[model samples]
Target: MKRTQARFDVVGQLGALRRYARSLTRDSSDAEDLVQDALLRACENRSSFEAGREVRPWLLSILHNVFVDKTRRSKSESLRIKGLAEMSPKQLDAPQDHSVRLAQIRAAFMKLPEEQRTALHLVTIEGLSYQEAADTLAIPVGTLMSRISRGREALRSFEQGRDQTSLKLVGGRDVS
Candidate 1:
């Protein structure tokens, strides 16, 4: 497939793509594959994101579709392309002191349904507006709002269940 070089910088969206992919797949390695596939598809399908539209949500929408398609294919075939999962970033763990807390939050975050996780990531982590996220997901704005609401409530519940006398969550730049 030929990629007409995008006028906007595609590389600039890498972090958000990776972050959203991680939230979707819940595995950094598979997340990388998802991002790669999405980027490839994005490059191949320039019409997917029209000029003047928010590229981040469009890229994310592509990533989300790729993940959904793969999940469906794997389920039907009864086999996942394990090779993709192995395409890890070779990232080392952060310090235990910080990693532990972040991991806990991540674990809790990951526990949410894929739809909820996706909505939360798009709005909160990626800083997309509700309408933008809704459009990206191809869902109604009301549905997006509901997902974000439920997702936030679940995270709040997760917080309440945790020990109250613990240090606050570590807000590290690295999502993976």
Candidate 2:
């Protein structure tokens, strides 16, 4: 029906939407998510899409709104995270507890399964979004998220046990 035609028209402008989103977001993965969010919005509300109207500008407006919404939500959080990233170089110049802690963390991370390790590294250390990391690993985003969650749990376990190799003197016997 007419709704179906509107939906098709909206889909037809995906290329233009992606370009506008990329310019607005300045990150391919973020742009992808923005376009996706816009498409979802357009599909959900396509009933309001007027007939005989150009779809490209509407889709671009949806994408811009989506990007603006995300920016607003992440503004405070990004400021804090960005501050920490900016401080990294100065922090590295100082010799502190990082030597032992870094080694222990690395050893623990190394013990993770390869899939989990790769997912964690890509999403966390490499600063890739879940979608980008999933694409890099050729796995579904759900699978990538599962691996990262499991990897984090394993790392938490190691930290809690502190390597689980220390012997404690108790009742005239060694307790591990």
Candidate 3:
């Protein structure tokens, strides 16, 4: 019974972790990986999770740290592999007719300034309220709003060619 209750508590937070990971990665595969990593970290540090404190936010904070670490490593490795001068818009925008739309969407997201992308991921994709996202990012609410607006505008303009305009939401909504 104790083990079952522990599993329930962890599984209950899976949706939120998946949402946050999706926002960070913008791809299902990467999101799954991020979630797995976060779960592993949570399990490894279980004793640190204070009793009565919110576990969901604590797990997400760990995820955020993991993302930052991975991003930094990726950036450094990319610089070494591609050479700084070779990493340009043209080079990154290689042709792909079969997956043009997906490529374009990814390219657009990659083009966004990091702050804007983070804001969009947290506020729009993750369905986090502006205040909550701001708290998570440790940014001022005004700055967070500005980043979200810029990110949305950029995504909209980039995907202007597509017939679909509405966001395809997944998971259940917290109506309350």
Candidate 4:
């Protein structure tokens, strides 16, 4: 691909890449950093990319790998204290009712296992097809389907206040 076209292709996928990064990182600043790192790596390895293939999935895969690497490296870092030290006290204010539901959903989403969360985010939130999402995660399409199913089930259980672990096997056979 021509240099100009290559640059344009990478730039065109920036929004999707940023959204996926935000879903993965769950923090704006960290998402930005992840996007930047992925872009840099993509540009550096541009020649390795096939000319006619879609770029979004490639960029997302790079972002996922970058996040995994960062997580592994940060595992050895010392814990940092978190507090409201940087915030200035303000007068008490009422919370927005609409935001409360969204917050609860977001909290529930954050509680899901990383694999399931990634599958759900890629397919439901990012609007990727099953094959595309599977390719991005380097998993089989069937595996992706299973993860998405489990993730949705877990979210539904949370909404309905059901205990997923309460079911017991019957006659040495599994029962869900």
User: Per-residue lDDT of 31-145 in model 3, one digit per residue for the tens?
Assistant: 9999898889888998787766777888899999888988999999987878855665554544576488787687777667788888888876799999999999999999899
lDDT of each: 0.82, 0.80, 0.80, 0.82
Best by TM-score: 3
The sequence of per-residue lDDT tens digits that candidate 4 reaches over residues 84-125 is 533545555556766897898898888777888999999999
Instruction: Give the range of the ten consecutive residues with the poorest summed lDDT in model 3.
Output: 167-176
Q: Lowest-lDDT window of 10 residues in candidate 2? A: 163-172
Q: Residue-wise lDDT of candidate 1 within 1-176, one digit each (tens)?
A: 23334645689899999999999999999999999999999889976666667788888889999999999988866544455456755675667878788898998888777888899999999999999999999999999998888778778877788432322322424232
Clashes of each: 0, 0, 0, 0
* Root-mean-square deviation (CA) per prediction: 28.2, 20.2, 28.8, 26.1
Cα RMSD (Å) between model 2 and the true structure? 20.2
Error of 2 at 162 (Å): 33
TM accuracy, model 4: 0.41
**Candidate 4 residue pairs that clash:** none
Ranking by TM-score: 3, 2, 4, 1
The better-scoring model by lDDT among 2 and 4 is 4
Error of 4 at 138 (Å): 83
| lDDT tens digits by residue: candidate 2, 68-92 | 8888889978999999898777534
TM-scores for the candidates: 0.41, 0.42, 0.43, 0.41
Which parts of model 3 have CA positions greater than 4 angstroms off?
Answer: 1-8, 83-176
lDDT (C-alpha) at residue 155 in model 4:
86
| Model 3 lDDT at residue 126 | 95
RMSD of 3: 28.8
